[model samples]
Target: MSKSDQLINISVIMSVLIFVSAWIVGLATHKLPVLTTVLNLVVGLSIFIYWLQKQIRINQHIIEGREIVVLGCELIVIACAVYSIVFKQWNGWVKGFQYIFFGIHLSALVLFLIFMLTFKMNKLM
Candidate 1:
């Protein structure tokens, strides 16, 4: 990967780790509302914006149906996060969003690792 891509990847990983850690800590202690809510929203929004930019750059053409769906998902997550922050409570809607966010991200990470492993194995063969 180029330096910029590496940097982006590192940042994404760090932010995700921080996000997870914050959630765990908040759940355990019920303290650090700023870290749990505000930081999470900021990091989540930044990640979504990064992905949106990359998607646009790659496609170059207008966003198609799939991109629109992705955008909607991002917006849903953002909206849920905002609602949770404002309400200061985790309702079913917020919990559902949290589950979906982690599920999507974790599955994508697993698929990426699988693809990279297969590519490397093919190169060795």
Candidate 2:
């Protein structure tokens, strides 16, 4: 497969993983402590890993820049924030959800910094 295709595949898999983790965390929102902790840790780490891979595969490195993907990630985060604020009740496993959100935010910041630091784009035509 082409590099871009492979990256898309991995990105899909990671997204599914994140979704399943959120489902699990929601299920375990009020249950056994051991199970809750295990699921939370699993979800958190999966989020971190997924974002890490995306940053690498998309090559949004602060050194070897790619601005669009970074911008796109930020857009996703903005959407998520709006969804969470308008829809969510702000309790009951919100912390777990926020942990995942944090991952997304950090990922966006990495992307933003890349172009913000490296590239010198013109503002006016």
Candidate 3:
């Protein structure tokens, strides 16, 4: 696999791990302030966008369908995050699932920083 592929894999793993962590945090915390809600929504959305960008083989492989399903899962997570953020509370498991999104965004932030250091940038025309 190429560096780009490795980066994507690492990012995906990070996303999943952070997502788990977030859920843990959410269940452990009871208060949902406005800032927390907005933060969660933003983080979830960011992860979904990143994964959607790298999931580039829907029509080319047998596993594409599974990947697509995962994509939908991510989107649902994002939706839940946004929902919690806006409403200040979720009625069910959505609450627990929203925190990990901030963790995913945190992981992505780290990877992006490493990428900036690893790759050189030039002016693109």
Writing each residue's lDDT as its tens digit, candidate 3 over 14-96 gives 75565555546655784443334556666656656776665573555344687677567667766776676567675566654
Backbone clashes, each candidate: 0, 0, 2
The top-ranked prediction according to TM-score is 1
lDDT of 1 at 54: 79
Candidate 1 lDDT, 32-85, residue by residue in tens: 454544654664687688876777778466667986787677677677778887
Cα deviation of 92, candidate 3, in Å: 6.3
Clashing pairs in 3: 22-99, 22-100
TM-score for each of the candidates? 0.58, 0.29, 0.44
What lDDT score belongs to each candidate, Candidate 1 first? Answer: 0.62, 0.50, 0.59
What lDDT is reached at residue 70 by model 2? 52
Q: Compute the lDDT for candidate 1.
A: 0.62
Superposed Cα RMSD, model 3: 8.5
* Candidate 2: stretches off by over 4 Å: 30-125
Query: Taking the tens digit of each residue's C-alpha lDDT, what string does model 2 give over 1-125?
Result: 35554454466556556545655665678533333333444444555566667778874566335555654544454444444456743445644555565555445445644544455544311
Preferred candidate (lDDT higher): 2 or 3: 3
* C-alpha RMSD for every candidate: 5.3, 13.1, 8.5
